[model samples]
Target: MKEILRSYKQTPASSIAARCIPITAKGVVRGRLRPITGDTLQNPAEIKLIAEWREASADWFTTRFPLSEAGTSRWLEQVWRADDRILFFVEDEECTPVGQVGILHYDPLKKQCEFDNLLRGRKGKFGNIMIYALITLGIWTIEELDVMEGFIRVVADNYRAIRMYESLGAEEIERTSLIRLEENGVTRWVPGQPGSSPPPERELATMRIKREVFLKLHQSNLPT
Candidate 1:
């Protein structure tokens, strides 16, 4: 098992240009997001354990595909070097990595990006970390990068995740239709609307938390 610690450092404002800003919420007790690096994948046991937790709880996540050790390592490298995205490992009070989260598939032209991967500890600590992270990121994007909006896509049935986002002021913009061709050559659409074939097991719901609302949430939560 991995040990948890709180020696991790906070992300600098300048560093957000190329790295994720590590942050700690009120009840986290300890831990914060850390920059993804080669060393992050050195411990395969911890990585695999987190992946299993995510897979077993697919309903709470958007993408169901699990990353292999190699895939995971490569992903860290891309996010670390990519200016369009930021990645971080959610570390515990003991410095042990629990789960991960990131902003990917960034489109600067649209001033919009997709947020995903808000995995928490096996015991479910740090569940609200993403809320703080998103709020901070949204403020940075708007004030620094001129981004107007941030978007997140969750599994339609992932009530927990949806509730979290809505609590932070995210609003559902549209329900997307995802078509998947099964092994039996059957096409499926999500939600399985009446008169329509049942969609794939995974359905996606897109939600947006505007820059203004995000800032409001951030300010409201700050110490008086």
Candidate 2:
């Protein structure tokens, strides 16, 4: 398992994007998860779609700023080359992207990783594509990457996301006050920084679930 993790970490982003991991539900392929590659940024339409989604879902994220296609292109370039992270696009069966998810903050020694950047851009014919996307990603981490646990941090007020995580067997494990940071006209909420005066009332909830627990809860919900 460690070797498998090492291999994935060493794989180039271009190759990763070409590899499609299917997201299935009820014995049907609902969507696919593919890593964002440099080629993805080359497509103007793709960049626009991602920027639009981020702008519309700004409030659901810690960082709130105006998103532009150029900015989105820069972010994609950075994330695709990251050593310990892979940002994925959730594409419907027809290969049209409907959302995005990511595996990041991996700790090989702990065999854990974080699920981040989960945002549903548009509804799919399956209706619950986002839920299946999350479940499928979780299963992949455990079965293929040997991740023992998966976790996510959500804005405390984001009740919809929290409920979805709970339904998939995650439980709130901790809460930390969020400190607002303003720089260059961009506002973001982050964990307390050193020398910070005081924590703000805004908070983020950390939710976690064991690999086996999550698998047991949803793996059987879909057919092999």
Candidate 3:
């Protein structure tokens, strides 16, 4: 939209920033979050993920995500300046790092944004669950911070993530098949192609959730 806070910028005096960013930096609380930026990308903590984590978390992110290495940095910078996007490292009770989660492209006017760059490097029993839990917190945090509605587009083939999102109260809205298209130096995943004999049946699952649903779920799970 070439619009408001296009890069996740933070107000120096923001109470939310003070309350959230420090804990995020401290890396103790689960789902602790901070805005991502190129400047912070090479922080010692992130460097550890690359030097320690088996997949070399840095490589995995660049390989799996749509952006190039530089592009990813730019994306982070943009997201940081916008201040709506959240980039987080999931932590366990003892402050062990588990994974990374993010929510970006938020539009306060429409009160929505897509979830992306959700990756988990931790292994074992709670490893997988930690990422999903972080995602849950990320979604709710976004809802409380800016958006009232949130949506995600999941590839039909990604059964695990789809199931997890459903577990988080997301309702599927569409299952239209899509095709991969490369035009004018840009690539897109879209439904069907004109005069292209109907693309393959593979598609994306559109899912949605509301603030109320997440809030009720969160409150219901909290101790009395």
Best by TM-score: 2
TM-score of 1: 0.68
Top candidate when judged by lDDT against the true structure: 2
Each candidate's number of clashing pairs is 7, 0, 12
Q: Which 10 consecutive residues of model 1 have the lowest summed lDDT?
A: 1-10
Between which residue pairs do clashes occur in model 2? none
lDDT of 3 at 54: 27
> Per-residue lDDT for 58-140 in model 2, tens only?
88788988788999999887776666677778989888899999888777779999999999999887899889888888887
Winner by lDDT between candidate 3 and candidate 1: 1
What digit string (tens of lDDT, one per residue) describes model 3 on residues 1-224? 32333333332324434433222212223344444444455454554462344234433221233334555455555556655566655544444556656677677778777776666667524434454454445444553556677787777787887888787778898876666665665545667744565455457788887777865765543323
- lDDT score at residue 212, model 3, on the 0-100 scale: 76
Query: Model 2: runs farther than 4 Å from truth?
Result: 1-18, 192-199, 221-224
What's model 2's TM-score? Answer: 0.87
